[model samples]
Target: MPRRLVKVFARLNPRRSPEDSLALRASVLASILTAELTILAMGYYGLITTVAVPLLTAAGFYISWRRRRERNLLIKLILAVMVVAAAVIFLRELAGSLYDTRLPLIRLFLWLQVMHSFDLPARRDLKFSLVSGLILITAGAVLSISMTYIAGLALFSAAAVAALIQFQLSEDSQRVDRVVAADPWRLAAGSFLVWLMLVSVAVPVMLVMPQSTQARLTSLPVSELTKIFSDFPSEVVNPYYREGGDPFDRPPQFSADSYYGFNPYMDLRSRGRLSDDIVLKVRSDRYDFYRGIVFDVYNGKGWEMSDEEGEDIVSSSPPFELPVDTSMPRGGTSIQSFYIQADLPNIIFSGWRPVSLFFPADRIKIDKYGSLRSPYQLTDDTVYSVVTEQPLTAGSYLRRFPRAGDPAAGPEYTALPDAYGADILEIEKLTRGLTGSYDNTYDKVLAVERYLKETYPYDLEIGPQRSERDAVAYFLFEEQAGYCEHFASAMAVMLRSVGIPARVVTGYTGGSLNPFTGLWEVRQSDAHAWVEVYFGSAGWVGFDPTPGFDMPGDASRDRDNFMLSGIIDYLGGIDFGPAGRAVSAAGAWLGRGAAWLTSVPLAQLSAVATGAAALAASAGLALRRLMLRRRQSRLATAGLSRELLRDPSLKGYLRLLKRLAGIGLARRPEETLRRFARRVSLSTGSADFEELNAIIEELRYSGRPRSDGDQRRVAALSLEIDERLREGRAATGRA
Candidate 1:
């Protein structure tokens, strides 16, 4: 009854369906399967689609094969219904944000591909399936943010190529009204080999290569707000850090996934290393520090935000206009979208001097230190966008803004909190000695920054500071080696002692720029701290006092070594070991060679290349022609090599064709044997080979077994054709 209803809804629209092609169906099926796996790899579903997709596609394939010969009006009608349903689902899913439509659109297309699989009776429908699979791969690439998607892309590409080759063979067979000799295995191998050759040619052309991957996404705008329940509107929340736990005692350090500096208070007394697990992915216009939280009140041990009661602002729409600090000199705007890959603090980490936000949360808080905060902890996959005013960060440009002590920056920024000993006095004396030569605040800040970096070696293996001894004092005077926090603390302390308004700021470094994905991959190990020294109208300019770290700035072109980025980092860490320096030296030499090549004019190189290619092509053509002529001459004179025939039945036929070719009467690729024989008879003024052609035709199509009489007739006919060809050749020569 259901089938009758469906049939009644649709007509028997039998649209030139081809004979059941098992090979073509299998290739298309493989391609569709590859695409499905790719979408799964791209994190399309949690459990529902993951389990349902495979079962549904498999069932569809089985059902399609079972009813391959049927002109099922019911199935077509159902598919039409599915198409409409999918369209409706997509339309319903459409939202204000572009990113919001991605998953729904993918789901729609993917399900449609699955549904279309069940009714693929025609070669055209199978081709449609193949093209649909290609689209799925493209969709996967669009969604992919890692180089791992290459595996799926490669698999789908091979399957699609095989399907195309099969499609071509099917078309050929249909045109000739017979099954082609090309089998599935041979088709796949030949097509893949051709595909590889095309890829090889294309790779160099692309080079003349551009990650071969770039930012497939224009924006990552999202809106999924989480309500804040804490006393402070936007309090720092680190899952790894124990909030009410004993301050003196260190928290459990098993995974070390979160950075301690991300908390409200950065306890220098706590010593451990952060994991390299990716915490964030940022797509930005340029590279800059993703500053999270800043601390003004600093004790001898650690740093903290004194003003916990921050001002909160609410906005229903995007983008939330952040209050700009009038004192901070702003320049061009930068748009950055942060994609949280791991649990992080509530801090709205943006480029320096943020003026606007696109965070999901309506209510956001801004503290005295100019750090914007979200309502809830940024869990995994949480995304937000921010637009910041990137200053003209040239040291000379900043130095132009002359200023004494910063009036805008309050006294809390410059004060050294009380400690046990006369450590403050000793630190003040030490800082004054280093900066006495420089008059301006910027120059003094530079001097302090330079001094700290030169004296201290950045090390992460150092033990926690003693309870009594100050962290920065010990780092500067005693230990002489510490990581980012140590360097930042020492610099900030020195700046404050020299009557400069400075504070320690913590967040992630401008992360590893994945050339493949074209996104900044910020990891837990990227958690960093640096000193922000206030320069009146120039504002709080960041300075990296760590030995190997550079202060994040708006670089015109920030380059990362892509070869050493994703894979090596994903594994524990990279270690070239003993010969690391030698490898580095070799890489340097290669870089120099590349640099030299870049200096040469492209047009001159192209001209020389074009000339060489033309010359090579001429030589190749000549060589191939010479080889072919020699082979043909040898074959024509070989006198009865019929024993070399794989099928003895076709030996006489082949012989006839070869002899006819010697007399300038070669059989065309598209010509039938009967038509060629008729033309041959006319040319020779004889009808001798007609009988042999008939025997072969019967054997080729009707599968008629050859008898002794047939074999004798074939031999006599071949000899007669050869004689006729010789006579024809002689007559032509005489003429």
Candidate 2:
């Protein structure tokens, strides 16, 4: 057998070798192609500026030039540098990508590859470069799972095959004196075919593998996604500006004034358009607008609302009555629940005096101010059910309040830095004038709210106008047309001036309701702010001073922008485009209306559809087989015999092997005829094994056509093998 194999190889090419020039050419081409793929993957055109690409090109040219061939070192070097430079710029642009920003790492790998590209003195360097390229492509896969990544996978596989061919070509080059053979295209095409076959088999195995068994990793670099509202319960210097608009069109942008942790980064001052609909959903029996950090003192630019240790206030729970008057009537309602998920934070946006809040799972914590909080960064959709009560009357609570005696309420709320513009006293005066007397706090709040709604008109173009000297005052007195913040701020300050206690509340309001699911969907456009009036009988009455604006739970706003809802619909094969509409129409025509399907319980419908599909497939396959059999019967048997008997007699032998496998031993494609026989021999009982050998020998050596009688004997042998396996199993069980 070994001698026969040697003869076959010798007949083909005992002394033939590929030339050095051809081998060198293959390496150079591979390097260049590899660089091109890297550039395409990174999506940056300025890679030519980097030294890496040039270095690689030079290395390739030098090797070629040293043998007296014309090669340009400078051109090679320039290409390498440009490719690397382009890659860097591409990565730099993805500073905010959470997972798909590994392009920089790929650039570094590509540069190393370019630097070593031309120096392919040893086959090892060339092989290593190709391998590194494959690694770079694989890394890119971690960024995205799409058709583009599949293309990269194909490219990587093809490269691997090419590398193998290069190794073979290089070996042939070293022995060129004997005989010459070179065909780069043929080698590359062969490698690609082999790679494709390997991948076809690998795909099934990969799908079977559990995702958890593989690495759970993110490709985002040093900078991670940062939360905007982390300093929960912190004082805000909120001189409210206009708020409320479409979140999808433009949303509010929040950034820390200073760096918090180790990650060093800055923001470009930009603001998103306000969302008119409330993004949050409160299911509490009691009504309250969800609240976040509150700023007591305004510094012209922003508000300072900190609930730090020194700023913490005493709680006002029942048993241990607050130092303030308990005689003040409290609102009867209790246990208000809220389901809120927004682009904003988990800092609760609720009525001022919240008694308790029911959180999703155990995610809620509280700051010293009794403000609800989140366990970690709030990214996913959240459902918060809070329990709260409002004061019944605003008048009684304002009198002889604990903080009322103290001139400075708290450092965070009172402190005015040097940078702060002087508008505090003016705001106070206007607030006092709006609310006539401290005894009628609710009346004062209403007066202030009415003034804002009557005075300023709602507009998004106020930011630039309000950026001038005395912007808030200008916005309240002069501009006449501003957004929610401008109106809400004016209202809050006016209420405070009359000693009718009040605070500016910023949160989402009036949400859009999804007709499909009957759930309020909040979008980026739902971000909003309104005034919370102090009522002694009720803790804090939630109110919106924006003239035409409805209070929370009024249920007038549209809410269809859940972050993942859109993405989930996409993954689940729900399309809203023209193609999707066509598909929907077709489905309806086929008695599979989209509405009906959506109405069905997801699990039950999926099960029923799967079963129906399986039945249909089985029926179709049976029909196809019956039709094929009928066609076969109409054909002449003699012609079938002629075609089978013409050459090789390989078909009969293959059928025999399959029959043998059906019982016990099976043959692998990679195995030789002899190896298959050896495995058959090991099976206990010689009934079918002996008979099989007789047939193989007759077919191989004798080259004789088996008679009908002989064919029957082979069939009998196949059945005997089946019996042997059955008997073996029986014996094992009986023992």
- Model 2 CA deviation exceeding 4 Å by range: 1-351, 354-457, 463-478, 490-503, 506-529, 546-656, 670-675, 704-735
Q: TM-score each candidate.
A: 0.77, 0.36
Task: Kindly list the per-residue Cα lDDT of model 2 for residues 573-654, writing each as its tens digit.
Answer: 4335786676665544533333344445656755765676577668768976887444333221112234344434334444
Q: How many backbone clashes can be found in candidate 2?
A: 91
Per-candidate alpha-carbon RMSD to the true structure: 7.5, 17.8
The CA lDDT of each predicted structure is: 0.72, 0.47
Candidate 2 yields a Cα-based lDDT of 0.47
Name the regions of candidate 1 deviating beyond 4 angstroms. Answer: 1-14, 58-74, 99-101, 177-179, 182-185, 195-208, 211-217, 223-233, 245-255, 315-321, 325-328, 360-363, 402-407, 463-467, 554-688, 691-735
lDDT of 1 by residue, 1-735 (tens): 987765665555744565477877888898999888888865646678877776788788778878878877768777888899888877876654454467778888888888988887777788788888889888887677677887887778777877787777777565422224555577667888867855665444433322322233355565465454444555777777677764435542323787888777887766777777888888787777888888888877788788766788778656778888676666778878788887777778998888878888777888877788777777877778887887666877777654555456788988887753477778888989988987677788888888887887788898756546777788777787888888899889988887788899998887767755667888789889988877777777788888877875534234322232232332223345767655766656655554544455767755765676577668768976887566554443233233435566656657766665555555544567787667656666667767767776666567567788877887788877677666655231211
Best by TM-score: 1
Residue 686 in model 2: lDDT: 50
For model 1, state the Cα shift of residue 545 in Å: 1.8
